[model samples]
Target: MLTRLELAKDWVRDAGNFLKENISSPLEITEKTRYDDLVTNFDKEVQEQLVSNILHHFPEDKILAEEDDEKIKFDPEIPHLWILDPIDGTTNFIVQKDNFAIMLAYYEFGVGKFGLILDVMKDKLYWCDSHKAFCNQKELESKKMSLDKSLLGVNSYMYRTNSGGLLDLSHQTLGVRIIGSAGISYGQLLEGKILGYFSNLQPWDYAAGSIIAEKIGFVTLTTSGEKPRFNCREQVFTAPAYLVSEIQKYIKS
Candidate 1:
């Protein structure tokens, strides 16, 4: 699994480099479900490259990814599965040429084995395997901090709508940060820069980050305060176990 994890990291790094190389190039962009929900040509290109490489190395593995032909449903019967978001923040990549990420998570027999998130411009590859989490090559240290003493990441939509009392919850935190990218936001959480995060996320959006977060004593749960169902889009929140109920109090419906 370590060997595969290393290979996966290499693949994500290559994808990140690819994105960086094209940052200034003109791109063909389009909307997905909404005008603000964007996808760019690079998004498809990166996803294709990563998915192709994965199948070449592990032909039998099933993939659930964001892009053409790769957005298939997960099948638990499959021995090996990969969840990928080729460019996690496409709008950011297109608009700012930064803050986007390449994220991938590997699972075996329905259990997570490895997860990788490469912050493209920052060149930080945050990753975790069964035993540990790291940024680049340095191991991460975990510290427990109270919600009130920490900044929290919130989805702008949730904050705007005050969905499930998100507005009230944000007031309890030291501050609120809405980083448009889940991969980047989770990286911040792992670094102890934030105590928690609440957002509506798809499987690819949270899979890699959640695995790495869990490796460092954080728990990713549904907004309802139950275990997350990774097979579908859901409202998700993540924080240390001690802070769960407190944060969930205002957000969980």
Candidate 2:
């Protein structure tokens, strides 16, 4: 598993560089759920690269990716599965040209084995297993922090809605930040920049981060108590277990 994980890391980094090189190219973009929710040619190309690499090495592994409908849909019952987001923050990739990420994770019989989130512009990769996580070549180990003193990562639009009285909750934290990318936000959390990150995310958005959260004793849950399923589009939240209770409290109120 370690050897395979190392190889996968290399694959993701190479694919990231591929996308970066083409970042300036004129990309054919189209709207998905919203005008801002975009799918680009680079996204498709990068997804193809990852899917091909993984399938060539592990021919039978199930793959769930953002851009490819023809690829194998995720199957939780499958012995091995790879959940991938070729470009996690497509809006950032398209508009700001930064704060985007390429994310991938490996699950075996529903157990997370490895996860990686690569910050493309920053050139940092965060990967983890049950034992430890690393940023680039440096090992990462973090301590839990209280909400009052800890910064949080959340969607500003959701906070604007004050849905579940979240506006009030943000006031209790050190500060609230909206980075527009789950993978990047997860990286910040791992680096101790934030105590927790909450977002309404799909499986591709949160799968890799949730696995890392588990490995590092961070919390992963949904507002209504749904667990991460294969390819479900739903609201997702992850932080430390202690912080989750407060988030749920706010939602319930």
Q: Best-fitting candidate, measured by lDDT?
A: 1
lDDT of 1 by residue, 1-253 (tens): 5477878988888888887877889999988889999999898899889989998889988898877543666766669999999998888888888898899999887788889999989989999879999999999878978767889898998888898688898888788998899988988988888888789999888889889988888888888877777777788988887777777678766
| TM-score of each model, in listed order | 0.96, 0.93
**Tens digits of per-residue lDDT for model 2, 57-163:** 88888887878765565665789888899999988999888999999999888778889999999999999866888899888876868778988888776688875
Off by over 4 Å in 2: 70-74
Mark the 10 consecutive residues where model 2 has the least summed lDDT.
Answer: 226-235
lDDT (0-100) at residue 167 of candidate 2?
A: 71
